[model samples]
Target: MSNNTVVLRLARSDDLAQLSKIEQTCFSNDRLSKRSLKHWLSAKHALFLVATSSDAIVGYGLVWCLKGTRLARLYSLAVLPAYRGQGIAQVLLSELEQLTQSKGRAYLRLEVSALNHAAISLYKSLGYQVFGAYSDYYGDGSEALRMQKRVARYDGKGIRLQVPWYKQTTEFTCGPAALLMAMYSLDTKVALKQVDELAIWREATTIFMTSGHGGCHPVGLALSAIKRGFTAQVFLTQLSALFLDGVRSEEKKQVMCTVHDEFITQAHKLGCVLYEKPLELDQLYKLLKAGGRVLMLISTYRLDGKKAPHWVCVTAIDEHCVYVHDPDLDASQQAIDCQHVPIGLMEFSKMATFGKNRLRAAIAIEKLP
Candidate 1:
């Protein structure tokens, strides 16, 4: 087959049956149903593409633009067995990636069975990097490797500011992990390792957050940064004790209070500035633009389905959105595992609050001038 003869175009309603047939023929398990294919073919914020030869469908690729973030997911891609090795899959992927980038998405992410060496090789050849793995991701108990590719965008110049990212090793360490990223961005000499991560967690942990070992409060995290010789400024909308609503026991509340008191004393002693009002989004943008790093507390419900407070680093900001380095890693999705995930400013503002108190906290850090 000649490459020039292959036709690539957006899938239509009539192509659903052929796409479903290709799905059934391509894999033993996790095949998309005909109904699902039909729905995705017409769904908003999604792209269904087909590659045809001689007016017959040979392969298809499905991608989803994640709402509220400048990222896209390659939900599935498949080529007919007999059509394999004819460059059909490559053609489909190339067109899909270009379509996604043209929509202003910065990353293309997908998951494949870890045992599928052929697919993995093809993805790597196309510059995809494996960032995480999930056990038993499929119905057949097979592991899946999450991979991502950066959709490069240049404004006739260079790229955005690159910020270092580190994933939290434990569930309760997102604050410390995010803090470490901000600290590292401000001072590259600061080393990041398991021990340092644990140490920072110990220093900043509130003893009890919503559940597990208490997450780091904004004051605690700011103290950790200050102790590391970085100038830290904390912005909080409320002055009340942090994370007290989730704790029912008076003793636990007192412990939280004690921790908050210690952070306040340390802040006063070290001359760390603590703003009693919320950090305006514009201020955050200005800080990032002025070579400062910000660690923000956000509700994970926006990124994942979990309604929990999580911390992430503000790496860069553009005209329409802010780029974040999320410390919490999702094994099943590699885009969330990578750095510089773009979140729209309005969505970010809505996601930055926690609890009934609507607590909004952020810490901006920079090396001493």
Candidate 2:
């Protein structure tokens, strides 16, 4: 195979040593460990492609498919010093983008060293745009520039909101955190404080869930926003007590029902419009276009199989994807992964429901002029 043309192929376990060698040769620091390379070769949501001239591997590119989102991340890419002028890096990267799009991803993202002018030039030449940056992102204390290229085209009108992210202080405060992000996007004077999170949770809690802190109900959440003097609207598929099947305790169920009923009554009194229908992304895009902030409820089951309700602020929406600011940041996820997340349009529609009852909920809020 050493005398043949440089062919591109999927990486295998046997290519581990060559891949590690390329990584070491191409990068002075921040090299991928053999263990990690081995893992990606078989990872369910990852793609590792290699370029080989005959037998020896000349270059490689790896991407991680962000599950439940229309996003794939180019984790690493490199070529041997001898192969630098052969355009192997570009070939590998282009193939990575095509593969990523074939997997239904709308965007392909990557982080490169801020000082890597050659790599940056290549990325720009390939239509990748700089979106953000990170300081001291590498082991050698070098900064990194975050870039992403839209791979799949969108059909719906895309709208992205300028929203500040606030991670939930506690597990049960995702609703409050999401709400605060939306509120602050509309009004800069609004504060993202722990006290505010707890207060909103107190006002919006369903009172009980399958276990620990109960999730927030759309009615209660809308009411919370109304209390804060923002105009609010709610969309839901059902109006009954939610998460009832999760808990078997009749007392807990009743407590949740009581809270739910109270919220509904207050929402009605406060003139919150309750739409007995599903809130589609097209509708969300229009709201975003009109400068309305949205907080949406989704099941964590689709995200991590937790089967719990989670709140995320809708930052933007298009026909192909729903951009969101997730308040529930796991240890495995970086801040970039949680901010302005792009959940695929169809994937989001499925994930926007919760429990056996398949409850769908969304709340739109706007500053009163």
lDDT of each: 0.82, 0.86
Error of 2 at 190 (Å): 1.4
TM-score of 2: 0.93
lDDT of 1 by residue, 103-176 (tens): 76777889999889999999999989997777998889999998888774643222255577788899889888
Give per-model TM-scores: 0.73, 0.93
Off by over 4 Å in 2: 1-4, 153-156
Best by lDDT: 2
**Which residue pairs come into collision in candidate 1?**
208-214, 209-214
- Candidate 2: residue 108 lDDT (0-100): 85
Model 2: lDDT equals: 0.86
Worst 10 residues of 2 by lDDT: 1-10
Measured over all alpha carbons after superposition, the RMSD of each candidate to the real structure, in angstroms, is: 6.1, 2.3
- Candidate 1 accuracy as TM-score: 0.73
